[model samples]
Target: MTRRPAPRPHPANRPPARAIASAIALSLALGAPCAQAGESPATYLARIAAIDDAGPELDAVIVTAPSAQSAPHHPGAPLDGLSVLIKDNIETADMPTTAGSLALAGNATGRDAPLVANLRRAGAVILGKTNLSEWANFRGERSSSGWSGVGGQTKNPYATDRSPCGSSSGSGAAVAAGLAWAAIGTETDGSITCPASVNGIVGFKPTVGLVSRHFIVPISASQDTAGPMATSVTDAARLLTAMAGPDPADPATAEAGAHAIDFTRGLATASLKGLRIGVLRRQSGTMPGVTALLDRALADMARAGAVIVDVDYTRDPAMGRDEGIVLHYEFREGINAYLASLPGHPAVRSLEDLIAFNKAHAKDEMRFYGQEDFLEAQGSTYTAAYRAARANSYRLAGPEGIDALLARDHLDVLVAPTAGPAWTIDPVNGDNFPGIGAGSLAAIAGYPHLTVPMGAIEGLPIGLSFMAGKWQDERVLKIGAAYERARTATLAVPRFKPWSPAPD
Candidate 1:
């Protein structure tokens, strides 16, 4: 889930901290069973330091806010008294937004991203930043998912030795472990969904234009969006209602004011009865256990009255290559502009400077892998090929991909396994995880995608994905809620196992 290049073409990774303001929404919407057994938000936050640092040693949280310790537990707004963790890439006036890198360790911007402000306006506490993949995993081909230069490695709460996935690794793990009511994670592609699926939580990647990208670290301007990660669909919807609104600075969000309404209002009302569901048979991966779980999920949806029909979706072999091209071109443009937009803080100012900073701090940043994607991004420029790739990729992924399938099948949403189970953490050779990804098409198309816990394999949680065309965020959530109701299994609780055996 990362990309950077100097030697080997880096894999790709997150934007910074998102905000969460859905505690009341969670309680009112779903009876708050996902809430940590009557624990107050303040109490949950107060213990985060102890839980994240010792014992299971999740390392999920990068820092904790002292103010949160004394935060009021009063009855107020919808998100009032809600505790949330921000990804380190997001700037907070009080804490350094390091993006899990040592280079921007001085990036105390003295301001909150608009998403954070929205959460605050809704009365949610800014609990502090969570560690992420270094530069959101845009450094090396073989880099570890949760290992960062500044925050070390983040472990899965389900299994200490398993992966939490990147670049929103900490946010997913923290939320799943009940370290916070919910956490915010950014996704250019798999940053949010992958980690959410990996850690057994619900992650929503709203339409890119639905949330403001201002004041956060850049990945791809076209694909990056900050969203909510929680234990339930209702909880995620609550945070998203707070996160969504028009931002004058973010041109992509010009339409957000119209489409972004209270997402939680109709979630429970969205019944599977008479709903036309399209099954992307080929896109669903072949991991036997994961496939079995997905099949069971589909059957569950069918029993609830969904009209499931198979859609033979075709893939353009070039989609992956083209997405890589677009990311490379955009990351170069976005990162340089983001660095220059910063206040007087000094360290790495551009991609070139960041590479140098990493090289200088090789003992930490380069200990596991190299910054080949940074080098690759540095070498890319505005070109006809880049433009062509962007146009084709967008068309194929959006119009000809998800949309074409829906229109042809007269379907409301598409379904698939969010991803395979979490692979063992291997910093030496990078992630060994596999998937048929319901994330990429929606991610590249800038559409709404949601993941909910389907079932667990060997005590490790995996998710079932629901996706739809642009601005169909509400529909996906409703369907997910319907599926959740249909599911016989309760939300699997993390037992903090040392490790889970491979599902045979």
Candidate 2:
């Protein structure tokens, strides 16, 4: 994998010390707005360009330029010229789809992943690829999110010093910072929802088979699916409607097509009325503020005429354990195939090459964390132990966890605090968390999970999740929209500030 140079700021927006000095000097010479009162076009252009020259501190994660081919046709077009920052793992014929590793950095397949093709077909602009955790954060035990060999480290737009959450870190950060109107994010476990929750955006992890994963870098074919992260539920739904469908490349699409419904239509404010919503009480016990937010949300839902059922998720941790095993085995096999599919391929077709690559480039790749997860994955084959673990995960997350509650309580959706808050981004120590991922049950069970911005702690956003049974993408979207409509949080755009002056 080769690391590409970061996209340069357009000359008009370049903010170097020299440029800032020039602007300051010009502003003084021209007397600012007084001169602008009847300024000529050239003067106006110069002034505007000066302000535009402010650089983003974390431009490594945000794509400044978009693809001309994927640009929308009109202002109110279906996607309305909305820019989409695709996760590096999701292929876009127009941009490099490196799965956050140097191994696949030079392997840009000149074909859009089906989801991306559909996004363009719906008039969405293909913005640059967002950086992610190397190999979707499947690299090591203490790996930091949003850091990739090819893309460097993606800083959180909110705090600048906090974690953005992996492996969809860039996607979440870009959308939350208004770098793009919406973005395509892929999730295997907490990839999509976790980042979205921390970034304070709407992250929709559709039912396992709901969205096609034809050209995306695979983790586990069983659980990987491309979804949307947006500033609002409506925008996310709009993007999802365009991306969900069957693809000849992925047989999983066969199950997705029948379940693919127009996710944006008929978003009713009363969608939650008469619905049975279960609260995952066990998940947010550590975060009191998060629990309070959920309590207020639950009361709001009840006021809107919904039934709430309190649940204890501790009844089964075995399910998560099993799913972890399946992911490990599947990561090895699936990533191996993805590596082999590259044009001319890599000298290392298996995980062994990756290990060697990291070893050789420890200064660049292993600066943050070791690849213990990859080592574990390499050691684990699709043995009987793997099968038993995978089976138990599905059985427990399904029949015992989700289905049991749904059947007994007659539930329509399950609600919980998606995650606590954005932890400080520590390159030395890695992420800090309470070990509560409520969306995992939905993810491992192939169900739909939607996270909407609830509020923030210290200006960093948090999200409330609403998960529904399999093939219930529409229901989840509808309920999420209702909650979003009841309350809204607008995210701020990132002000560009170069990491430092250009090295001579």
Candidate 3:
């Protein structure tokens, strides 16, 4: 809820001239809720499916995620019946990983991505794939998140008019709307966390290499990693623990596996007691009503005996430019590798092919946005800028940022408002929200970051982020579980409606 301004003097007590101005100020201070209550998947899917027809057009999102078809039914597996929603870009044998574009619309992979394999090995059911921005929104500058030619647009369950906030839009919205128990989302920059934050769900972006990016579409191999999006931090940790490991297909896996740990053990409420947390004041000030919520959160932390150390932001030119350079170089390299792995796909086989297809199919692909980012990537080259930015990102978000603050302040973790309230979804102009994400440090550092539903803005929910340095997933999970227990908010689900009438 938005906060009210401090009370003003009584009209008779105050100077006559100031009465009108004070009233106006107070009225402006009260803002509307930015979020709406989300529905549970089991309840909402039937209704949603009725409003949204299920067919070939929207199948990619579901086909690529964990479904019964994708799972190995043998006994002894850990996640046997647990459903998973794979992002469209991740390869799945049963469905095409189109990256939401028509360029590879008819293409299908023969093998599952390493992460899906891991999910299956753990006994989870492969539910289906979730929709996402085409090419993870790297294809265009004005591209809308969650809009794709293959799956159309994924409407946010909270408000049909608001943007879902992502490249992982479908994954975030589906999980939050109760389409599944948990869904897998991949990120290059803010794809996973931003969507999770906006949707009021738990989002975890593991350290780079902690999860293999082998068959997943990439923007920058330097930063991209697959993580979990779920209803709670405990669920995210459970998924993360199952997915972490090495893959011979991805060299980055070596580093990740070495740092991987069973992140779900030692559940504790006392973990919050005496823990030191760095709060980045810069990340939380943009939205209305957020400060009050954060204040309450901080007070709760204090009562729990956690120490808060506020981090001061010093402008660093290098840090600002890292994500751009790294993504451009990686997009060019990653897309090419993914295409070659497809045995005999037609229509799109390379970035150039994707560009041509967009040009050829302007009415559908270019209906909302153009391929300017793809154009930019096409013209861009891997230069010293990329290497320099990579190093700076690692330094700033890692040792010089989170690690330095932790050691200096004797901290255990970090905290922030994940993102502000959900914004209205606009197809023509796209999303417009008042807040910024607070997960950049952990994301860029390749550490683990988790966001849980803190409270509602309007009727919609908002999230609070908890992050820790590499391999401290369990510590954060424990803290998150405690918060969930205290909050006791039930998750929402999508209500599916029937498509056609049937005779009895």
lDDT of each: 0.81, 0.72, 0.68
Per-residue lDDT of model 3, residues 207-304, tens digit only: 78888888887788777888998766666777888898888888988866666676767654435666777777787775666766676677777666
CA displacement after TM-score superposition, residue 299 of candidate 3 (Å): 2.0
Candidate 1 on 232-276: residue-level lDDT in tens? Answer: 898899999999989999999999999888889987777999998
Clashes of each: 20, 9, 51
lDDT score, candidate 3: 0.68
- Which residues of candidate 2, in runs, are more than 4 Å off? 1-13, 16-56, 59-66, 69-77, 268-270, 345-347, 488-504
Q: Per-candidate RMSD vs. true structure?
A: 7.2, 7.4, 13.0
Per-residue error (Å), model 2, residue 89: 0.8
Clashes of 2: 9
Worst 10 contiguous positions by lDDT, candidate 3: 27-36
For candidate 1, the lDDT comes to 0.81
**Given candidate 1, what's the lDDT at residue 352?**
88
Please give, for residues 118-204, the per-residue lDDT of candidate 2 as tens digits. Answer: 887877767567788778888887777788887777766556667789889888876665445667888988889998988777899
